[model samples]
Target: MTAPLHPGRFAGKVLVVTGAAQGIGRAVALQAAQEGGAVLLVDRADFLAEVVAEAGASAAGFQADLETYDGAEAAMRFAGERFGGVDILINNVGGAIRMRPFSAFEPEQIDAEIRRSLLPTLYGCHAVLPHLFARGGGTIVNVSSNATRGINRVPYSAAKGGINAITQSLAMELAERNIRVVATAPGGTEAPPRRVPRNAAGETEAEKCWMADVVRQVKQSSFMKRYGTIAEQVAPILFLASDDASYITGSVLPVAGGDLG
Candidate 1:
């Protein structure tokens, strides 16, 4: 079941949520707006405007490729200008692009995985620092994955591992700065079909089998033996981004049904 929205929980705050065109990012943006936040939804997807409309007057959308530092910086600058300053940043841009055995991955494929699943968060954190500092204090919620310890996507796993390290180290470094850094390691989540499939090319039979294996491993590892709903993932993310979790930082709360990945 989804958690109930706490009206005004985010009153007077400005929030930036990446990958907001769909799925968990979409959920967060709408909920935050409903809770009184002025939200900036960022995505390169064509459907971004739809989410912005759904989020109403309190929300706006920015289209940017977060994989590059320039794109990341541009998004942050736009947010700062539009919202007057940003108080919370949810780095929801990363995802595994392909599912296959490590040996089957070409060198370029590995690079793509790292670029997709790591660089956005890395660039986002760096780009948003000045804005957060300007605000006196803020929160950063990185959406990681429990697949870091599962099968078929070694490069993606390595990327999430990097995020885990970033959360820990950045938290300690910024604690004195009044900025909180944290992450949520989500398990297999049952989201609606993607508007933009991660791998645009149609999957070969071999690739399909490999993906099936990944699904199997994910469910088997989770103590609940099932994927979670998108709401289940978004609730904790908002918690970490809210003042309710003011005392929490440098932590990766696993929303993986007891499979602490």
Candidate 2:
């Protein structure tokens, strides 16, 4: 079950949620709009229009490839133009594209993993800073992962570790500007099947085993011994992005049922 919504909590705020076509990003965009935020749902996926419709009249959609700086800048600029200015940003555009043992990964595959899981958040944060500054200050909530210490995804792990560092360092630098940077490291989450798979190629037997091991490690590491719901992940993210967490910054809250990765 989802948490109760606090109507008007985000009244008068403009929020940009990357990867808003699905999963936790979709949940965030919908709930934020319900709570009175003017939301810009950003994603490159064609399904983004569906989410925008589901979010009602308060939300708009912007399609962009967040992996590039140009795309990130364009999204933020469009948010500013559409909503007056950005008061919050949820950097949610990332995921591991492949699952395999570190030694088994090709060099190009490793590069792709980093590019997929890291660059969006990096570019999003950089591009949104000026807009947040223009709004006088705002909050940034990055969606990191607790899989940083898990098996068969070293490149993705490194990418999320960089997210932690970005949250910390950027918070320190932006505190004086009244801008807060924070992150949530989510563990295994249960949601509907993806409309777009991370890896379009089929998995081989060996790759399947590697992924199974990752699932095992994730369950064993978490006290809950099960995956969380998409609503579970969305609650904390919106909390951090809201003024309720105004005093919080530079912290990476582990939504991993006690696995502090």
Candidate 3:
């Protein structure tokens, strides 16, 4: 569904969102456009043009890997050269590329996960802040996870915990610059889990039922006893990215459906 239109909140602003090709990233990017900002959408997804079409021309799509400085550099250049400068930087990239049993995690696996899940939050902030600060102020909203509350996903949880730290630290560092920094942590919701084709090729009904049971267990962790909506969670995110949240910073807003309680 499209966001409610608000022309003045982000009018004439240049915004950028990393990991914007799907899921929460797509929701955030599209909402940013609806609110009157021109958005630079970044991700490794090849079909970003479709994403732009979905979000519209106020949106420009770019494919930039988050693994290396070269990838990050290309993204920074795209924003400066094409959009002039960014006024809102949304750090919406981060995820578990692969899952592993907690007991079997290798140091290399943990390091790689950190680089993927935490580094983009770091690089996007560092890369985009100069443009924002140069304009004398801007907004940053980092997407984190409710996994940080407990019931860890091994390295993914550890990495997200680190992201929360970055969100807090950056908020403090940028406060004097008139920039607002905050984060949104979402709990397990109706959003489908990433599909693993090879593993599910011949799953049995009993096996699937067991998996469903596990998901219910995860959902019950929420105080509201339900999952959140893509649109519902995205509202708080857009708020933190808007002038409405002008006085908010260094805070981690939960879209976890009351899960932390």
| Candidate models: Cα lDDT each | 0.94, 0.93, 0.78
Of the two candidates 1 and 3, the one with more favorable TM-score, higher being better, is: 1
- lDDT winner: 1
Arrange candidates by TM-score, highest first: which order?
1, 2, 3
Instruction: Please provide TM-scores, in order, for all candidate models, with all chains considered together.
Output: 0.99, 0.98, 0.88
lDDT of 3 at 240: 87
Better of 2 and 3 by lDDT: 2
lDDT of model number 1:
0.94
Model 1 residue 149 CA deviation (Å) reads 0.5
Expressed as tens digits, the lDDT of each residue in 3-43 for candidate 1 is: 57999999999999999999899999999999999999999
Query: How many clashes would you count in candidate 3?
Result: 0
Clashing pairs in 2: none
Question: Candidate 2 has what TM-score?
Answer: 0.98
> Which 10 successive residues of model 3 have the least lDDT summed?
192-201
TM-score of candidate 1 to 2 decimals: 0.99
